[model samples]
Target: MPALRALAAAVFLAHPAWADTATETAERAAADLREAIATLDQAEGARNRIAALTQTIRAYELGLTALREGLRSSAIREDEIRASFEAQRDTIGQLLAAMAAMEAAPGPLVLLHPDGPEAAARTGMILTSVQPALEAEAAKLRADLQEIARMRALQVSAHSALQEGLSAAQAARTALSQAVQDRTDLPQRFLEDPEELQALVANAETLEGFARGVARLQSDIGPPMEDFASAEGTLPLPVVGTLLRRAGEADAAGIVRPGMLIATRPAALVTTPWPATIRYRGPLLDYGNVMIVEPAAGYLLVLAGLATVYGETGDVLDAGAPVGLMGGDETALAQGAGAERPETLYIELRRDAEPIDPAPWFEQTREE
Candidate 1:
C-alpha cells in the first residue's frame, strides 16, 4: 500500500494540470485577430476597403495557422484523448455506485462483531485486492482532468478565431461593393476612348508593355507634370515605414531589382510624395498590386505591393494625395530569425522606361 501510494504521488507530481502556456499563446493570437477585424470594420472608402479586406484575410490565415500549431503541440489526437477520458469517467461512476450500495448496509466496523469475523476477513482481502485498482483509477482521473482543461481552452481559442474570421468576411463583402461604387464615381481625365484603352490593356503581354501603352496615351493628352527633380532630398516617403532593402540589393532570389523596399504597418496609407498623374493602376507581374504615376513628363514613379489603390489612370493627384495602402501579410518576415518584417512596399522610379535608384529622392531622416 505504501508503494502504491508513492507511485500515485509520483504520477500526480509528474503530470500537473496541463500547463496554460499553449492556451495562453492561442488566446494572444486570437486577440490580435480580433483587433485586426475591428480595424477592417472601421475602414472607410474604396481604397481603405481594399486595404482592410486584404489585411483581414491575411490575419485570418495567420491566426488559423497559429491555432492549429498550438492544438497540435498541446493535445495530439484530441478525439482519442477525449474517448479515453470518457471511459475513465464511466469506470469512476460504476465504482461510486458500488461504494454507495455498500455504505447503505452496516459500516465496515460492523464486520468486527462476533458473528462477522469471517465476513470481516473476507471484506479485508477484497479491499486489499481493489486498493491498487482504485489508486490507478485515481491517477488516471487526474490525467483526464488535466487533459479536459487543456482541450476546453483550445476549443475556446478556436471558437474566437472562427467568429472573427466570419465577421471579417462579411465586412469584406460590403467593402467590395463600396470600392466598385467609388471607382465608378472617379472623374475621367484622359480623352482616350475607353474601348482603345481596354484593348490596349488586354493586348499588353507584360507590365512593360502595359506601361508603354499607357505612356503613349499620356503623351497624346499632354497632362501637366510635376518637377520631381527639384523635390529630390525633400520629398517624403510615400508611406511611413522603415527601409528594409535598398536599391541594387539582391533579394532572396539573388535578383537585384532596381527598387527600394520599405516595411510599414499593416494597411498603412500610401500617398504620392509629389504631384503626379496616375498613368496605370493594377496588378503587374510578381508585384501583387501596383500603381504607376507620372510625376514628370518623362519620369514615372512606380509603387508596387499595395493591397489597395485609390486613383485611376489619368487622374491628377496633388502632392501628398493618398494613392493606395500597404498589405498586411507578414509571412515574408516570418522567414527570418528575429526579423521585424512588417508589410512591405516596393518603390521604383523610372526614366523613359529605364529603372533608376530612388534612394536619392527621399530625405535621409525619413530613411533612418
Candidate 2:
C-alpha cells in the first residue's frame, strides 16, 4: 500500500513542470504577436498623417502654380499680378498655416480647414477682389476647394483603415491574454490528466502553426489578399546589409524575443505597405525600421533595423520601392556582438508566422 501511494505521488508531482513550460511558451508567443500588431498600428497612424499632409501640400502647390501661370498672360500685367498673385500667395501661406493647425489638432482632424471662419471669410473677400477678367481667381479657388475635398476623402478612407488594423491588433492582444490565462489555469484544469499534459507539450506542430500565423500577419497587403507566392514584391530594402538574428530570437534589450532579426547600415531604410488595405502604411516598429511583405499565403517578407521609414501607408508601391533607409550609426550598430558587425539589416522569411530559411524564397523570386 505504501509503494502504491509513493507511485501516485511521483506521478502527480512531475505533471506540474511540463504544464508550466507549455504555459510559458504560449505566453511568450502571444506577447510577440501582440507587439507586432501594435507596431503595425503605429506605422499606419504615421502613414495617415503623412498622407493628409501630402495631399494638402499638393493641393496648395497646384493652385499656386496655376495662379502664377495665369498671371503671366494678364491684360493688366503688373497691377493684376501684384494684386492677384500677392493675395493668392498669401492664401498659399495661409493654407500651409492651416496644415500646421491640422497637425496640432487631434486625430484626422488635420484634413479639415486649419484657419477658422475668420480666415475663410478673409480669403473669400480676397477672392472677390481678384475675380476680374484679368485672372481666373474664382476658378482657382474652386479648384482649391475640390482639392481639399479629395484630401478629406483620403482621410475618411484612412479612418476606416485604422479600424481594421486596430481590430487585428486587438485580436492579437486578446489571443495573448487568453494564452496567459490558459497557462495560469493549466495546473488546475489538468490536475489528474498526466497523459493529456504530456500530449499537449509534445505537439510542437501547434507551436509551429502559431508561429506561421504570426509570419502571415506580418506580410504586406497587396491588391487584396495577394498570396505570398503570387505577389511579386521584394523585401523593400534598397541597400544590402548584413543579416541579423533569426526569427523567434531574443532581442538585445531583452524586452521580448523578436520574430526575426535584421541588420542594416546603421541608418538604412526598409519600407512596406499595410497589407490588403490601401488605408494604412507599414513600418510598425522602432527597433530600427521594418517592413513585412506578403507575396503568398505561406510566406512573408521582413526587413528590420532601418534608419528611416519613407512612403505612406495605403500608397501602392512598385515591386522594389525604397520603404525606408538603413542605419549607419556606429554606436547604434554595437548592439550585437564582436567579429560579427551589427551594422547590417536583417532579412527573414516566415511561413504562417513561423520562421523558415528565406534563401529558397529569395531564389524562387529572383528566378521568376
Candidate 3:
C-alpha cells in the first residue's frame, strides 16, 4: 500500500500548478520586441524606397524643363519630345509601383487582451483562463492591423497624387512646345509680341498672390506649440540624430524656419507609448510632408519634411504611429537648386509665436 501511495504521489508531481500566465507573458514580450524591430525596419526601408522614387521624379522634372527650354533655342524636335515623354512615363510608372510597395509595409499595433505572466501561475485555479488570454491577444492584433491598414491607405493616396502631378507637368510641357512650334520666327515673335509678354507677367502675379494667401493663413493660425507650458531648458532630442538646424531663424534664404530640426536615426527608436490625436496631417508651405500630433492636452509635436504622409486629419493616432516617411531631395517649392541634403526632419515647439527648444519635452518623455 505504501509503495502504491508513493507511485501515486510521483504521478501527481509530474503536473505542475497553473503557471501558464508567466509563460504567456514571457512569450508575448519576446514577440513584442521582435515586432518592434520589424516595424522599425519597415519604416526605414519605406523612407529609403521613397527617396529613390523622389530622385527619379526630380530627374524627370529636370528633363521636362530642359526639353521646354530647348524649344526656345532650336526648333521643337518631335522625336526628342516623344523620347523624353516616354522616359518620363516610365519614371512615373516606377514611382507608382514604388509607392504601392511602401504602402504595403506593415508596422506594430496595440495588443488588446495581452496575458500577464501571472496567467501561467493562475491557470490551474481559474477555468478557461487560457481562452481569455488568447482572445485578448487576438483582439489586440486585430486593432493593430486596422490602424496600420489606414496608414497604408494614406500612402497610396500620396502616390496617386505624385502620379497626377507628373501627368499635369507633362501635359503643360507638351502644350507649351506646340505653341512655340506654331509660331514661326520665334525670336521675332517673342521680341515683338506685347500680348504674350503681358500674359507672362500676369501668370507670375497670379502665382505670387496664391503664395501670399498661404503665408497669411499660416501666420493667422499661429504655431501649434503655443498651448504647452515652457519646458525649454531640458528638451531632449527625440531620437539619436544630429541637429541639422534650429528653429526661429532662416537658413540664409530668408524663409521662416518654423521649428527645431531633428533627424530620426535607425538606432534610435522613438515611440509614443500612449494614445495621441493627429491635429493636422496636410501640407504647409515650407513645411513639406508635415504632421502635427497632440499626445496629450496642450502638448503638440510637429514632424515635418516627410517624403510621404501616413496619417490623415482627424485620425486618432497612437503614440509613435508613423506620421510620415522622409524622402525626396527637392528644395522647398520656392527654393531653387541652392538647397542642402534631401534628408532631415524639422521639429519645433511654441507657446505661441515664441520659439522654444523641443529637446527637453522629448527628453522627459524618453525618461518616462
- By lDDT, the best candidate is 1
Per-residue lDDT tens digits of candidate 3, residues 1-368?
23323333342333233343222333333333333333333332343332333233333443323322332222222333345436545443443443344355442211111575455334323323333433343343344344345334433443343344444433432333333234332111012213432343345333223223222222212233233344444444433355666655577688666566665421122222234455455555555655655544544566656655643344554333334445543323112222334357777554333335565565532223
TM-score of each: 0.46, 0.29, 0.31
User: Candidate 3's error at 247, in angstroms?
Assistant: 2.6
Ranking by TM-score: 1, 3, 2
Model 1 lDDT at residue 350:
80
Q: Which stretches of candidate 2 lie over 4 Å from their true place?
A: 1-238, 244-262, 269-286, 330-342, 363-368
Candidate 3 ranges with C-alpha deviation above 4 Å: 1-240, 254-258, 264-274, 328-342, 352-355, 364-368
Of 2 and 3, the candidate ranking higher by lDDT = 3
**Model 3 lDDT vs. the true structure?**
0.40
Could you tell which candidate, 1 or 2, scores higher by lDDT? Answer: 1
Provide the lDDT at 324 for model 3: 45
Model 1 score (lDDT): 0.65
TM-score of model 1 (CA atoms)? 0.46
lDDT of 2 at 75: 20
Number of the top candidate by TM-score?
1
Give each model's whole-structure lDDT: 0.65, 0.39, 0.40
lDDT of 1 by residue, 251-360 (tens): 99997877899877555667788888787787766778888888887788888899888766777666766677677643333221233447889898887777778888
